[model samples]
Target: MAKILVVDDAKFMRMTLKNILTNGEHDVIGEASNGKEAVELYKELAPDLVTMDITMPEMNGMDALNEIVASSDDARVIMCSAMGQQKMVVEAIEQGAKDFIVKPFDEARVLEAVARVLR
Candidate 1:
C-alpha cells in the first residue's frame, strides 16, 4: 500500500478522494485545501503520491506539481481536472504529473491511475 496526499479546494472532493484511495488500500497521510497547502504537506509527509485538483485558490495543480517535483524528482502527482481542461491536463503531464483523473472521477479510473503510478 502506498501513502498518499489528497489536495482539493472542495471538501467533498477531498472526501471522495480519501474514500477512493483508502478503499484501494492506500494510506492517505494528509489532506490539503489548496496547492500551497499541498506543497507544504508534501514536504512534511512525503507521500507516495498526490491527487491534485487542477483549479484551486491560492495555487493551481500545475504550480504545485512543479514545486513538489522540483523538490523531489521522484514525487508522484496525478492531476484531477474538469471535462474541458484537457489542455491543462496535458500541460500537467508534461510538467511531471504521473497521470490524471477527470472530475467527478470514476472509482476504477482513480484506482487504475494510482496503481499505474505505484507500479
Candidate 2:
C-alpha cells in the first residue's frame, strides 16, 4: 500500500477521503486543509501519493502541484476537481499531476485512481 497525503479545505471531504483510502488498504500519512500546508506536509511526510483539492484559500491545487513536482519530480498528485473544472484539470495534468478525480467523489473511482497511480 502507498502512503498518501490528502489535501482538502472541507473537513468532511478530508474525512471521507481518509476513510475510503484506508478501507482500500492504503496508508494515509497526513491531511492538509490548504495547498500551502499540503506542500509543507508533502516535504515532511514524503508520502507516495497526494490527493489535492483544486480550489483553496491560501494556495490553489495547481500551484501546489507545480511546487510539489518542482520539489520532487516523482511526486504523484491526483487533483480533486468539480465537474466544471475541466480547464483546470487539463492544466494540472500538464503541470505533472498523475491523474484526477471529480468532486462528489466516487469511492470506486477514487480507489481506482489511487491504485493506478501507485502502481
The best candidate in terms of lDDT? 2
Candidate 2 pairs with clashing backbones: none
Candidate 1 per-residue C-alpha lDDT over 19-60 given as tens digits, one digit per residue, 9 for 90 to 100: 988898999999999999999999999999999999999998
Query: In model 2, which regions exceed 4 Å deviation?
Result: none
Candidate 2 lDDT over 19-76, as tens digits, reads 9999999999999999999999999999999999999989988999999999997899
Give the range where candidate 2 is weakest over 10 consecutive residues by summed lDDT: 57-66
Which regions of candidate 1 deviate over 4 angstroms? Answer: none
